[model samples]
Target: MNGKIIGGFLVLSALVAGAAMYYLQVYAFYRPVEVSSPAAAIRLVSLGGVQEAMLTSDFEAIDADSSPLRFRGCFVTPMTLAMLSETFETYEDPTPLNAPPWFGCFDAERIGADLETGAALAFLSEKNIHPGVDRVVAVYPDGRAYAWHQLNESAEK
Candidate 1:
């Protein structure tokens, strides 16, 4: 009947729209960030308000131009937490943003929990890296580090 056909069409349309939305959000906009890109640099803010680059290796990153908060990075730093804490301004509150599962390196939940338990230390990578977003970098004792851009207090207000 006509009613049945119309209902089926509506259901089909919704399913198609859902699939497209998922694809765009999870895959379309993101691109592998190259080592040469500024986003891949692991720099922290020094106590004197200067941004200093740290010694980082095995860097892997992903970014999406669609939003400033979409930048995420994973790397290893030779600098110990003791030296880093002494050298840079520590971030009082650090919350990491989740990356797509395909990326596999940056796990926001694990990083956040580590920060809560003192298993990792978070540093202010760059304040106001975007208009109202701050770049935060959290490092574990084993030299594993992850970076992400998050909304600052100003932006949250």
Candidate 2:
């Protein structure tokens, strides 16, 4: 009877720890990013290597202090793809990071697939936003856009 009690206690303790870990990783650290925040700006790197703010609207974003890669934003841009491509430096590789499911606007898998098929184009928002991490924006032809922070080549090296 003592052994049974000990085994059940151990199992319950393990289950509780696992649940707490999941909650902390997926839900605890993130916070809604306000429009007034600098992280909310939808800026792109110009051909001249300057970061310029683009005209964006309906912006909704979330970020976490825990990691630079935790930023994810969804917005609408009035700028056409043609104008942007001609003006901004295109990001050769844009890997969207997964956002917590509660933040429904940003979908990393869909954005990544769109980029791969040329359904969307990725541009450098800001280089080295956080040491080796960069801010990348991916836009569809219809002006639907998303942004996320990813590790740059320097970080990889």
Candidate 3:
């Protein structure tokens, strides 16, 4: 009886430890990044491919008043990631998602409806248009974007 009780306790403890580790990792790696200001947001986005980016005013109604700058892309590149990390201010996010292959994530104070809508759709879309999207970007005022296709790795390995 004593041996059986000890074994059960050990098993339970191991399971609990495993779960705690997973929770911590998910939150740490996938937390939203904090930005210092709107300029930082624009500067970060500018470093990436801007050919597909649309002006917030032209794309949506919420950002009509914010016309001091221009936006041109939805995603950022490795060349810009390091520069962006330096440009933006990030902190510990209270909540994070549980997705596999988490590359990184950040929170933006300002963003347009189009980007938010598109990113959310990508996350919940039926078709896997952007597979390997492990990281997420939580936009303020209810917006979100997830990063797919990590740049650290090569396409043809």
Candidate 1 lDDT over 1-157, as tens digits, reads 9999999999999999999999999999999999998788779999999999989999999999999999999999999999999999999889998899899998899999999999999999999999999999999999999999999999988
- Per-model C-alpha lDDT, please? 0.94, 0.95, 0.30
lDDT of 2: 0.95
Q: Which is superior by lDDT, 1 or 2?
A: 2
Worst 10 residues of 3 by lDDT: 57-66
Tens digits of per-residue lDDT for model 3 on 29-112?
333223333322322122232212211211110111222111112343332323333444321221232233332232222222
Runs in model 3 deviating more than 4 A are 37-149, 152-156
Worst 10 residues of 2 by lDDT: 36-45
For candidate 1, what is the total of clashing residue pairs? 0
Top of the candidates by TM-score: 2
Q: Could you tell me every candidate's TM-score relative to the true structure?
A: 0.97, 0.98, 0.31
lDDT of 2 by residue, 1-157 (tens): 9999999999999999999999999999999999998889889999999889988999999999999999999999999999999999999988999999999999899999999999999999999999999999999999999999999999999
